[model samples]
Target: MERLQGKPFPAGYNPEVEHVAFTREPLYFAHRLLIFYVVVKCAQLMGHGFLLLAGHRRYVTPTHNLTYWHRPCQQEEGSIKQPPLLFFHGISPGIWFYIPFLTRLGRGREIILLEVPHIVTQLSFEAPDRIETVQSLAEIFALHSISKCAVAGHSFGSIIAGWAATAFPQHVKQLVLIDPVCLLLCLPDVAVNFLYRSPPTNLFHRTLKDFIDPSSEITVSHALRRHFWWYQNICWLQDVSCPLVVALSSEDDIVPSTAIHYYVQRHYRMQEAVKHEKEDDAGEMTDQSNASGSGRLIYWRGIGHGQMLVSLKAQDRLIAAICKQAVESGLATRAEDIKNSGQKNLRRSRVTAA
Candidate 1:
């Protein structure tokens, strides 16, 4: 993995990812090897079928280290040219868990899915650290000529997506972070590590714990906590100029709801302060109504960290919020008009049937 040359990383930053160098006794090694094989097979079976149906295309960068999957819209050039949506999945084997949401979200626009380099690499080696991964993702975006997009991330992916907005604010029109972990104030590093490795309480987390590469997950989790722990890293959101929506689950076990609330409150308060400052100066705020640069926070009840992606109610809420933001920011046109038009058509059909 190549470090971002000509640019300095942040203080105390490590350029490369470090893996656990535990000596593998034959029996233990074989056991782990078999488990890994089963995990990979399960991921392939569940995820590949959806990708085939969606016509998903995976491309390896000319440099080979950076690769991503693209699922183009089946029908483009609609009445409105909506901005494309890019997804960063949580800590799962792949984006297989999100295929349902991605398929639905890709209705009229293209969808791009990014895999963690370490997880996707065929070689028996770890990939770059968080910072390099972010840079690599930006490289992919630029390579594809995607100047503006709606970037969304879930769980671990949220941190990457957030950094993407901060790193390439010029290119991101909107950012949606769902069930983000370790972005806000949280327990100590020891507690975080313990909870991450603890037994899963549900099927979703169980799948994540089992399928994801353990060495990579542990490495990234600790590195991210060290690098991006609330005050040190997430506070950078204060500098993110794009419109942001943070969705939180009140019953989340991995990330405390209090931390999420703290982040949302603090961010909006700061935005409000900025708005007030602009008002006092009698200067017009920049794109005040644009969804590309606003902060909106929402809380959902009963949804856990994993359920948010699969729950229909949760998904509907997220989709509605996105639509509302897009309509308000003028990213999606004729939404209301189209809905009303569709309603009229439905009513006519019912009457004719009667």
Candidate 2:
């Protein structure tokens, strides 16, 4: 059975959690929603949209069952070597807002984007059991005939991905966490700043908070306050398997990214040391240091949470991580072809496989 004991908030988080009152957002929320809704609609009208993707099979929100959209590989299976991507999105209205990022990610492989209603819908009073969430994900995996896949998640979704990795190790081949809230969940930062903090007084900050930031919204505050359980959501690096990449944005307003960056890097180095001692051939042990691209722990400077949704450069960086296996595979095939053709290229790029 899963533990129900929740981590306590630091004294600095708030004087009293139950007594703390929430602030009202500006009236522009409705207007902003309509305009963004139009933008999503326009993005749909242009050429392709996520809604049209196949396999919507009766997605029910109340029971905590997840619905997924799969984008199959356009290329031959032999040429594409990357594991199938099982993606979980962060707190957002819907998956429509993430088309650009997902589109770039789906270039050469099967990508399954799973939808989370509890975080996005705000009306859900309880987040599903982590075990149940992974079971729901397994259903999608079975649909795609995928036994093992790389799991990638953002923010709230990262919590689910971490649970999946820890709980079902055999099924999760790799993990990529971005702006993840689950890493240092025991810390008071997210709950205190995102849900319980007072609204910004400055006009510009107020506008940014009320209009752009979902954390400033009343329902989001309620969702985190009532439904979020810190201990249940927390993901410790000690529990995870190998080939993990943690991407933290230095300017993230929600999660304490700098702390997370250091924490993850230190954990990986420690894990490498432990593995090295166990193996007779220490050379076989994986190197997960900050300098090693394999098992990378990236800290993106000047980037904010959810900025990758629009920024192609940010998406490309993440894309490189997600598609690392494919690039390596392609390079290997090129080298093989060059060798067969009798071309003498003395130098070859060294690749450390995850």
Candidate 2 residue runs with Cα over 4 Å from true position:
1-64, 76-79, 121-126, 202-208, 216-219, 281-294, 325-354
lDDT of each: 0.65, 0.66
Global fold similarity of model 1 (TM-score) = 0.71
Clashing pairs in 2: none
Q: What TM-score should be assigned to candidate 2?
A: 0.73
Model 2, span 54-117: residue lDDT tens: 3222343234555566766554434544667778888876666666676666655667777676
Q: Give lDDT for model 2.
A: 0.66
TM-score of each: 0.71, 0.73
Error in Å for residue 168 of model 2: 1.8
Clashing pairs in 1: 243-292, 243-293, 243-294
lDDT of 1 by residue, 1-354 (tens): 125476665668566744422222111110134566567667866686768667878776554475568866555443444677888876665667678787766677777887764433122335455567666777778777887888998877777787788787777878888887636533443235423345568988766655453433443433333333354335256666777888888887677676667867887887777777776787666674233235778799977667876788888888778767776776666655666778999999999999
